[model samples]
Target chain A: MAQFRLQGSKVLAVDLAGDTVKARNGSMVAYTGQMGFKKLSGGGDGLRGMVTRRLTGERMEVMEVKGQGTCYFADKATEINLVRLNGETLFVESDNLLCTEASLRTGTSFTGLNGMASGNGLFTTKVEGQGWAAVTSHGPAVILRVSQGLPLRVDPGAYIAHTGNLHRALKSGAGWSTLIGEGGGEAMQVEFTGEGLVYVQPSERMTLGGEV
Target chain B: MSYPPQNPYGQQPYGQQPPPGYSQQQYEQSHQATQAGMPLPPQAPPYQAAPAGQFGAPLFQPPGGEGPQLWDAGTLPANDNVNPYCFSVDLNGAYYLQKGKMIAYYGEMRFSGIGRGALDQLLERNFNSPLHASDWVVAEGRGKLLLADRAYDLNSYDLEDGNLTVRSGNLLAFEPTLQLKQSIIPGFLTLIGTGKFVAASNGPVHFVEPPVRVDPQALVGWADCPAPCHHYDHGYLHGVLGGLRHLTGIGGASGEEHQFEFIGAGQVLMQSSEALMADRSVGVIGAEPGIPGAGVPHQQQQHGGGLQGLGNLGDLGRRFGL
Candidate 1:
């Protein structure tokens, strides 16, 4: 198994010994030992994932790094977060996924209207199985727990990812006044209910619904 | 040799234990202790433990009992910062914020633009800058509202019968107790009376007393002081060579030739960087004669055409080397 650890808040250091890890294309900033880099034609999910990503417009350019030594990966100096999955699934935007251990299975899932409002399309990338996956955020992402009666409402642009069993629905704060340009600036939100942890960056991306 | 027993979650590899949640009292003590010693990193968990509430969720600890502190409604601070870049407001009544500054919120909240009829009363009392009306919105109802702006450093200021003038783009949100007005200086807004207001800076804000001449890009705002005036280094443009350098970059004009000069009793706020936030339009002023920046004819109009139809004569003098 490749060992994934943070070199700092913004860099991910993965120590591998003849093991492979899937990472964002061109995210490898430096490496200390023999490493083989291969571009996975279709997100490393084979033909099915490639086809799903193409059709859903959730395209992810991924590269496979196999080697023996420490490899560092970073993206635009954004903050990196490491998540450990114990036979569970982690759903995140493809743009926010920095790298994932090859042991984790990567696939695409339909996110419905929540994705459209966030300007991220209708499909989200999911990493499952047991492995360490790294996610990127505009800032240090805040992890909020949503369980039972306590629900979490996230601005579409600030939401990065979530894990565990949860239901997401698009909730609109717009009303009749919104029609006349008096609408709440936060016109669209993703309401998460059930048990899970949501990751929200302290910064908002420019979304289609943000100005409303 | 074994990499110090890597934890399953990989959080232990760093070896620095994530700080435990501190109750209000403990937080205060730790804060004072740290203040007495080495300062805590700016991103250190600045939130306090949740006050007991009806819907208190179990504090979330990541798989290895580590990672960023998990925040929910109960734990969110009231009118305080969640991190240096994020602020949490315990909203019960109403709060005015620049549109789209909110990242997330827990509870019942409605965001309405300032133009709505329902917010007319609120605007009449707290909002007076018609020019900035379009750039702001009101968050009302109950719950915890989070406000952030491009992940910049966010700090909240409390004004007690005082006034503050900030760059339009830096002012994020404010309590209703403060009445907002347009500053005479273009691209700045003034807040009067008492209440808390949140502002964002490119970096941590530093306070300096005037008389001070500050780089325009580094200035965040000023409190209880008169607006600043522009100061130009006369020596930089004194002679022919200086004028040529200023005009055509012949001798490399220093970028610090111009600054905002402040000479008053109050404090001036400046960010550590020279990167200025995108300026928000403060709206057009009445084009009346004798009004500065009113789009009326002025002596120093540099643009080609003037209100008097003078054509491109503004630059004709430079062509003749006059």
Candidate 2:
């Protein structure tokens, strides 16, 4: 088992004791002990996974790192978040995944119209199984919990990822009022209900739709 | 080894992680069921707030864990920062925020554009920037609202029987208890009375006692003082080379040409960076006579008193874009 920890907010330190982990290609900045790196064609998801990745355009180049003592991974100084998975599923943008354990499975899933509004993609990357994984963001990600009576409304551009059982609906306040430029600034939002956690970055990404 | 040059598209070619749950195959099995109109089982119920060693569901970590610190409707702060870059305003009444600064919120909240609806009455009392009213909104009702701006450093100040003037673009939100008025200087607004307001800076803000001169680009705002005036280091402009450098960009001119002079008893705020922020106009004061930046006929404008013999009226006229 590889122990995943943060060197700081920006650097990810994963300790591997004769185990293998998959990381974004070229993300290794430094490492100690003996390590072997081999490029995994098509996201390390095997042949069919590659085909699906190519079709979805959520392609990622991953490398398998074996027998590493302590390996440091970082990408452009972005803040890294570590999530431990005993057995739940995480849905994230393909571009936001940094690294994960080989025991976990990565795949693609269709996200319906919610993707269209965020200007991300029609399909998002999904990770499953047991193990630890890393995610990156422009700034620290704030995790907000949603449960029975508390439904959370989030700006599509600020949303990064979320977990647990939940349902999402694209709520819009746009109308003739918006046409005349009197539209409320919070016109476009994604409402999450049920029980789970939603991760939102402090900064928003510019999408096809104007800030809403 | 070369990692990808920062994504040319700026946003693409990037990462994500997920905590393990019951199972991926199981979620997929139930995901399809839920997608097909069969109501799926509810996820983990709102777990009691995580204690020191025990973790809650996906959203929260144990008190000392890497998971996010959870703040529910009752636990969120009233008018404090959730983080350095994000502010959580517990709005019981109304607050004015630059349009589109909100990232997320919980509970009941209604956002309305300014200068319209019942908001006009509210604006009539608290707002004075009519021309720029379209770029603002009134967030009313009660909720824990989160506000952020482009990930800049944000700080909120409390004013008790006092006042503050800030650059229009830097002011993110303010309480209705403070009356906002246009400052004598262009591109700034003055808030007087007692309330809290949030502002953003290129970096953390450094508060300095007044009787100071600062680079205009670094000056964020000042409190309880008369308008600042320009101070030029005219010693450099004494010779012909200086005149030529000022007129044409041929010779290297020291980047610092002037500074804003602040005097009297007050506080001056400056950001670490010198990059200036651009803001929309707070409304045109009309071309009335005697108004400082208003409608004076071009010919009547005066020349700079500092560069007397070196430049004449024509050169000075162009300098101020008269």
Candidate 3:
């Protein structure tokens, strides 16, 4: 467990493994996982030197902060980016998780939630808060906010953050023939609906895994 | 096939029948003429006669006919010691700034496309510049200056070693190395002059001069003062993928920026300061005092127009010599 301190509505803590301290507002909930960081001067002295190193591409472990107030976690993963969104919501992710404060929500039921298909099982760890929430990512994420009548769909793994109110559904790109190959057709999908935000990693899962 | 000439009861008409065996040659000629269609009216040849020893249209054909032939494939003598200022691409295509006038790659001047026309103005006026202020335009960049739309009111003063100097009326300077330019916005001008600066709304700014001493308070100032402006973000977005022309960048993915269309309107997006480098989500804060459209914040609107007149009107009224 990482140690965290509270300041006003914000919580600051050092990631024991990653040696980095993270601060977040109490109104926000953050999850932690093993992510990478690189060495640099920690932005603030209150932050430990080890934490700064982690921020600069040093890998650290991951954890989830349920209640708000800032919480810090570290991992041995590199590449960290923070994205901000509307309504003071922030989304955090590790390994190419591109989420922002605008995408925080508790539920899903939107047009773009599940590739235009209804009843798709698309679930995002939603956070409903009114403060700054910090998220991390290995690569950049593309945020797209679709409006009413127009929906959005994305690969579940590619989603780093999203809003809660957007409806959730599952879609299958595989047709009947393709389904036969996979124990009777279970295609990968996570659909979203209504008017809300969706964040996608710039690269698709196929390309990213190919690189690895 | 041979046919007896229609003689109207064995009488030959003028220009109708030729001597025997001449018909085959005539048939061949007619066949070729019909296949080729009517001949074009002969005019002076398009290209001047190729000088001796110079390759011409025939050279365009592949030597073995194995690969598709392309014109202008042969390499020419390389040019040495070219200046960066001389060779750059504007809207139309690659061009060279020879003497003072800009010369296009194809030597034609009339622009045929809107994108090229915009590119023309960008490269000629905004490349490798920190600030360019004329009567109609203003530009800011790191080593390259970029004049945004509606910028003709700019001054032409070259900075040494790509150093940027802001004129009294001008309020923009960009650092080339960092590829960032500083321009006027609420609460940014005075603070940017000092290395200690702040970006209020999560805007990306290249430090013209490094922060001599990194102070947390100063860093806060740096974080709070300059929120990236709207037009600049568009420009940066257009050029972001230039770094990776091949892969792992914008070029490899789409080789184009995705344009979102507005409902029944031209493509216009609401500009905000927080989404400077916005990737996934955009955060918008209506700092305009009082709820918009309910009651106009008269004082806020007046001050928000700019920091120049609102701050100095009172002082200027008192110090008049006349």
Each candidate's number of clashing pairs is 1, 12, 121
Q: What is the interface RMSD of each candidate, in Å?
A: 7.1, 8.6, 29.4
Question: Stretches of candidate 1 above 4 Å error?
Answer: B1-66, B299-321
Compose the digit string of candidate 2's lDDT tens values, residues B1-322: 0113231222211111112232445434432322121122222212233332222343323235545565444444446566677777878889999877888887677887776777778888899877667777888877678888777777777677677888888889999998898777878888888777888888788877768999989988887664588877756554567556655646655767678899887778898898676566555677777666655654653544544443432354245333
Q: Estimate each model's TM-score.
A: 0.86, 0.81, 0.23
- In order of DockQ, best first, we have 1, 2, 3
Highest lDDT model number: 1
Per-residue lDDT of model 2, residues A1-212, tens digit only: 98888887899988999999999999999999999999999988999999999988888999999985999999888778777666888877777889998889999988888777767778888888988889887677777766666778887777888777778877776676777888777777878886666777777777654453
TM-score of 1: 0.86
lDDT tens readout by residue for model 3, A1-212? 33333222122232334333323212223435554332223322224523533443322232223332333433223223333233433332323232212224322222343422322222222334432334443232333343343344444444555542456555443444333321111133444555444554422233211111
DockQ comparison, 2 vs 3, better candidate: 2
- Poorest 10 consecutive residues of model 3 chain A by lDDT? A203-212
Residue A47 lDDT (model 3): 49
The residue-level lDDT of candidate 3 at A136 comes to 40
Q: Model 3: per-residue lDDT, tens digit, B249-309?
A: 3434332222212122111112222222112111222446653322344453332333233
